[model samples]
Target: RFDMAGVGDSELVEGGLLYVERTRADVVASMDALSERVDSRRFLLMGLCTGAYNAFRAALIDDRVVGCILLDGYSYPSIRSQIEHYRKRVFQLKRWVDFTKRKLGIDTPSGSAVQGDLVVFENEVVSKERFAGELQSLIDRNVRLLLVYTGLGPLSFTYRRQLHDAFPKIALDDVATVHFYPAADHTFTLPGHRQRLLDDLDTWLADEFESETAARG
Candidate 1:
């Protein structure tokens, strides 16, 4: 996928929340251009981390987006998730081994951060009700969602079905597709983890849109 303005190597230009307006405009422009040359108008948006949040907001604003693939995106604080996260951390021998290595300066963990001052990012303050509302709106528009979380994500998303637990009132557990890879970090640092992510993505893409020749914008 192409980078939104102010992202990647592109020159930074600030806009509204999460740069939604600029991103929306850029995406729509690309969609129009793509549609002129392609047979289908429907679109799918797949993004990671901040890109995922941007894609999600863009989908809400644009009806052409038929589906979204969100990786290591939004999640909220919940007791169950906290328990699960710490429980695994405390019980897993590998976790302690890795921690000891880091503590001993034998292993330095790689970060998934963009070294720049142009764009500022903080945790999004999205309440459960608001998030549920937005999700329902997308659902009403027939936008299929594939939500995936990695080990570096929020504690609340430790389990595959925790999305529902985070928002029990929503029917997302039954409706939305969710996956979790506890071994994978936010950026899939390991080769095996990256391959697993690609494999899962391929299967999801095939299962959802194999019959339709749609543009993935």
Candidate 2:
């Protein structure tokens, strides 16, 4: 539940892209703070959505970071895909706005993905400010932008397969990789699947802890 300097709990500056800093010292300092709080020589990291990317970056640097678990990791798409997706969204929003205007004689702004179900695309939804912040952090830290958009993308299955291959190598004695509840969206809350997701998460965590204990003996 710990956050880095420019994010949630730490909240450094109040301007554009707080996480976009070149200070490796700052990154490690944040890690040090979290590590001290937990009173542990080694720690497990878990991230959801953009948090996954940040966790990945931190794990790469700190050996004390013994393991990581990521859910619904988003791979950055090419500029072309970003532009296309943006244009498509704009067109769809315009169409919706026009229809609403015709029907109600007024236009409504879109709601944010954070506020409600993103698929529903409510008119009252506000812009997701987190995206710019998160993406900027990823870019600043040079976190490997996955092949393309994180969830169900062109390489979704491939990325999972690669991770599966890496599992044996990564889930070593003190070090481990645990992916809980496959396809559980970002928060591990998807319709008609919470039970299955919970089961998988429980199994993965149990196995990880068990394996870690056995390694100690």
Candidate 3:
């Protein structure tokens, strides 16, 4: 639950590529400090959106990161996901209402999904081959993962199992734990959505590492 620099309780800083780099450094530094202070050898990193990317990159460089819980992380474009994503929302009345509001400028999201103050970061996905190689390398090292996708704009993460469909070359069927929640928004704003996510987290952590943690404790 540590807040890295440029985020809550830390010195505010400009967002963008620089912010991404800063967080990567922060994650490594935090792990290093934790290793020295608590005599901890292994760690699990969790991040949301861009932070997830940072944690993932850090895991590649540091073997100490044994697991990650990535929420709304890198979502590659998939025709299948796109069709299903649009199909689910196109018929929904709420979608029409929200579209109308945006068209009329009644409730516009900040930055319009492009470069702007709030949207300093774009939903840029790494190349499929490159990403597959990187991810497979991590898997080869036995890095455990929990990937989650919600009803963030289709551009962010449209559906659950998007990761599997996006990268069939990688044997993620058994390697990763994935969950999707189409009813929840990007940030899990609804109480029900948040509760569901928390419950899932509890279950995942317990199943994956509770025994090891208890033995250490």
Candidate number of the best lDDT: 3
**Which is the winner by lDDT between candidate 1 and candidate 2?**
1
Per-model CA lDDT versus the true structure = 0.75, 0.47, 0.78
Rank candidates by TM-score, best first: 3, 1, 2
Off by over 4 Å in 2: 13-27, 74-184, 214-217
Question: Taking the tens digit of each residue's C-alpha lDDT, what string does model 2 give over 19-54?
Answer: 423223454566687768975666656665556555
RMSD of each: 7.0, 10.2, 5.4
The clash count of every prediction, one per candidate, is: 0, 9, 0
**Which candidate, 2 or 3, has the higher TM-score?**
3
lDDT head-to-head 1 vs 3, winner: 3
- Number of the predicted model whose TM-score against the real structure is largest: 3
TM-score of 2: 0.46
Better of 1 and 3 by TM-score: 3
| lDDT score for candidate 2 against the true structure | 0.47
lDDT of 1 by residue, 38-69 (tens): 85578898888777877887888889999999
lDDT sort, best first: 3, 1, 2
